[model samples]
Target: MAIFKHLRVSDGVAAQGDGKLPAGDPDPPPAADGAHGPPVTNEPGSTKAWTWRGDFGASLVVVLIAVPLSLGIAVASDAPLVAGLISAVVGGIVGGLIGGSAVQVSGPAAGLTVIVAGLVQTYGWAATCAIVAAAGVLQLVLGLSRVARAALAVSPAVIHGMLAGVGVVIALSQLHIVLGGTPQSSALDNLVELPGQLASNHTLTVATGLLTLAVLIAWPRLPQRVRVVPAPLAAIAAGTGVAAVLGWDVARVDLPSDPLAALAAPQWPDASWTSVAGAVIAVALVASVESLLCAVAMDRLHDGPRVNLDRELTGQGAANLTAGLLGGLPIAGVVVRSTANAKAGARSRRATVMHGVWVLVLALVAAPAIELIPLGALAALLVAIGVQMVNLSHLRGVHRHGELPVYLLTMAGVVALGLFEGVLIGLGCALLLTIRRLASIAVRVTPQHGGPVRVAVDGSLTFLSVPALLRALTAVPEKAVVDLSLNIDFMDHAGVTAIDDWRTGYERSGGTVRIDEVREHWYAPGRSGLPRPVRRTPPVRNRAAWHPLAATLSGRRQLEEGTEEYQSHVAPLVRPLFSELAHGQRPTHLFITCADSRLVPNMITSSGPGDLFTVRNVGNLVPRHGEADPNDSTIAAIEYALAVLPIKTITVCGHSACGAMDALLTPERAGNMPYLSGWLRHGSHSLDRLATRPDGPDRLDRLGRENVLQQLDNLRTHPAVAAREAAGELELCGGYFEIAEGRLHILSPAARVPV
Candidate 1:
């Protein structure tokens, strides 16, 4: 059986009997040659030396490209050319020694050009270096704490799309340089001058650059053996050689006098409180973004090998800190070089270190030869690199996924503003798109198969949802029984009001409605009642029988069913008033009254349930049908009583000094009392009704009666009621409830009457 050891690169490998290779050893064995292999103490001794010969050819080609790129990026970032070389060396050597991914190469990345330039312009170079040191420390801490996992939490789509966007930006910016035109320092300036730059500089240099691009595109299609050479390198070599031999008068990097003397330690800046703080934040963010992105790419390429992102970040930070101290710019994990290393058969961190060694050796030995390379040629190389980074395929994928708006908006924002701000805007758009997708589906309230109609609203319902409710209610079959249930935790006032209106309308249209368990509002705990000035009592304990009735009464216990208190307190008064209702032409009228106990329809109409055929609910609401299935019972009962029983007159009695009415009158009070405030909006018509009535009694009383009258008018608008009324069989009446005197006054054309 193989003894599993962490030191072995492959899983399930046994450790050697002797203490040799240990975990965390930076120098590990190469997978090919046995020379200079680190001995394995824990894992079975496997003598394998990492081969560099196979990659020598590829590495040579990469160095050609890397040299030019390093200089160009340094120039772009407003840093000394040696800074780029230092970064490349440190990134490869120090980063490779500590980084989690074996094949990833670290260097001064082009993506940092914009950030470094900005930092230099804002804070002096010294401060930026200090910040870079701090950022390195932060990355080290992050790696030790394993905080790099957070980078993986970003959505795959977002990361890919971001990379694609970055690619496009890079490609566009390089176009000017490729055509032998001077590049603008700022992204905005470059974009603004692109067309004019192209128009003015349409020279042979442009043709040569395009031809180079074409050759790069066709290189992969060449024979399999020939395909080993990367397209970009070949393209650069061809383009640069042609331009040089032809002596094209194109823009080129002019080597400074005493290039070797420029490679000195960077001066440390005065670390002020503000400058340090700003630089640290900027460096941390930029480095984190770049390093984590490279780590993720390497992870995918490794077939899901866990990447120590924090370790990678720490390596990056360390590199940056060293680079800053050595008078070099900040550095990060560069995708181009990392990819190149991976493709070149790098088996361990040795390849990265070797790449750094190569850069250092070349810098020391071939410094003069590097000066011979033209800036325009390097610019063309950079242009090629930038073009390769642009991922048009990813953009197409985003469009295909129906996230075109996100793609376009993000691209536009990045192009117009800058990277960070553009990403923020894109995030906002993405959130909005998510909400819209969630909101698109309507909350359906309908009967379940062989069960009561269930109204299912999965999301938030607000004023904006009113039209949906209205449309839904109007679509229900007028004759079918409905069980309206509002199973939502959050419902706004407009939604509640819409529900009330629907209830009233559904009942009037000869449909049944029922309201299931409705959570009580904190301020207004009882059922929704008429606007009135009355003392409120705590709700009764037994809810099954009385809760529904009590909710309809808005906490006034005077009209409770099966209660000795109600019989003693309210029966005597109602019996006398209802005597006239008993003999009033077979009770051809049904009045739906507010649940407020003080506004008893019997007292107002001088009728019993048999005489007036009354139905009561909190706020005397007529909510739209099918808004919720809980309302089905209430609606069905009303429809059965009005349409089946075929009542001639339907009245909605509102009372003065009513809770619902008062709640509606003062919005602040409603705010203080949420549930009641939401329910009270149903009674807004009371204000209109009161306005139409002449001043009489207390204003609340007048308004209460007027509101009842207005509700009567609203009831007439119901399809069933309108049809019945048009047939000369139905009529509407309005009445006001007086809580103080325990009296109900009906509103007649001539005068108010205590029926």
Candidate 2:
């Protein structure tokens, strides 16, 4: 066993990953040699490892479970039982030796059962081996070109749909074998002949199949101690005993005790070259895709090492080639064994390799005992797995996300037609859904008070959206002026023609339509037949990027199609108020609050500029009446707003995440600046109020509410404020702003509630 380690060459030194270090986080720290993580060398017994004992134990458990699964998948795929054992050995040895992943197990996966069956039926068994070899070459080339990741670029819905389709096919065909009837050639044929198969099954064969199925389905619910034997093994063991006692005529796996003497040689294909070539490419693509996806899922198990997908692909290719040469079943990464390996505390790929070695040893040493597994028992195990593959929970999750249509369409196509056709239709559905989303439109018709009705359209407009847009436009009052605000990202000729035709008809009926394009020109208006050159809107310039007078004309076209109410209507209404207040201002209240942009004093108080005097600071804190500090910005504003203006009340407000309150709680923040730090000394009074509550994430908001009350008290300390309030001529109050709800909350002595 090798120690858990990794390396990367940066500068002159190799960066190393320590297994003990925290690496599970998405953002890991820079490596020791300061290079992005690179591959570590894999070796055996380089040193006494931390988890050698655990890895060894895990290997034993995995081999026991893998043996039954391998045999069952081979039976389902119609391959020779020895081919399953051969694939397992080659997968463990070749795949584990050179794979990029640390612990993902490669073996004869059930995912490829349908593909293998099709290949074997079309070509002879020996020629199918040749096709597997050809497919391995494709995988090797793909890995060498570092395009393994590209296999996962297809939509996950399509992949899952294809798998579910395969599952239904497996269950339908394998059911016939389980019931002691010969299976039909295809899923469609199986479905048509299923009723006849059910009517004419041997009584003893049905009993054996039912017993095997019951054991498999009930094994998970068994007591933990009794489950020490794996589910597949337990089910097969029970079926074998029952068949012997009843003297049932059931099919069983036939294998020679001397496995080496029974190995067959690969033969060249005698079928059409086109059909053979298609099978080879399909096998290669499907196998590579499944392996890569399994490796990615397994990566979350260990922080010890990240997988190199390209290298893992190369490893799988090598393993498959070796398996094919030996006339074995094709192999790919198996998630069940990989998950078991991870759970069993596998620290390295050594465990993965050892599991394969164990299977090889078992096949050669105990071939007679392995031959006792009943074919109906294996089919029973496969039936359970096939049902699981069409998981209803996963389908419900897909349905919740509006993807049921795609999944159902793919499944139906595959079950009724073929794999290639089903996948094409599924992919085609996904593409159409994507196109629909990209060409969707959102249109709103708002009737302005004593003004033209505003028809606002957002998102791209294509031919698909034209009919809906036309229907929506018909509701606008006849012979009325319409403000058409189009903020479209893209527009095609069909869309342009629809809108132009509608506008022409509307105008012909004495209705007026003004088209204002936002951001960029999507189409040329009034010149509908001509091809309009598309152009992108220029990026807005920042203050630093601005030239002399570009700001003056920027909003002219934008305001014509803008969402800002001030630019369209409010500014004109407020100009008269601004003119009257320009000479001098008289406000009734002096409002003090945080300088956060969202905390607008006028908006919160429902007051115009002339209605209230404003004072804004970091925390809305007020110092007690005493000697003035060097930082007097807030105090100066308060004094002027109180003495110079006709202010009748003083309102102090604080808000969530008040910078001053946070600074008060965390003292270290004050270390860098002496002036702002000293200025925040007024906020310390709010900390004294914190003893009322337990310390937690909500402490800042609690302290902020208290700070406002403290500031209100501080206002009373000022002689001018005290004298006016003493005479009952002025009012003082406190409040905090709730950012989430956009409501002002008053902090009363008894409780804080929204007003």
Top candidate when judged by lDDT against the true structure? 2
Q: After superposition, how far is residue 216 of candidate 2 from its true place, in Å?
A: 2.1
In candidate 2, stretches whose alpha carbon ends up further than 4 angstroms from where it belongs are 1-48, 224-229, 241-249, 448-619, 622-755
Give me the runs in candidate 1 sitting further than 4 Å from their true place. Answer: 1-47, 50-65, 123-128, 153-173, 202-211, 247-261, 267-276, 303-305, 400-403, 434-755
Clashes of each: 69, 0
Q: Per-candidate TM vs. native?
A: 0.53, 0.64
Number of clashing residue pairs, candidate 1: 69
* lDDT of the candidates, in the order given: 0.60, 0.76
Residues 1-755, candidate 2, lDDT per residue (tens digit)? 01101110000000011111112323223357653333233465322343565568778878877887788778878888888888888888899998989878888877788889877887878988898888888889899999989998987677667777887787787788888887888898998998988888866667777787788667766788997666666777889888887777767889876789877688879978898889888888878888887788778767667899999999988888888899888888876677667767787789899988899899988888777777887776677666656655457766877788788888788777878888889999999987887667888888755557778777778888887888889788889878787777778878888888899999999998887665457767424465544653332223223322225435653354343534443465578888988999888888898888768787777777788777887788788888457567778887787778888888888888777788898988878989779778887777887776678778888888878887888888899889999998899988888877778876785564435
Question: What pairs collide in candidate 2?
Answer: none
Task: Choose the strongest candidate by TM-score.
Answer: 2
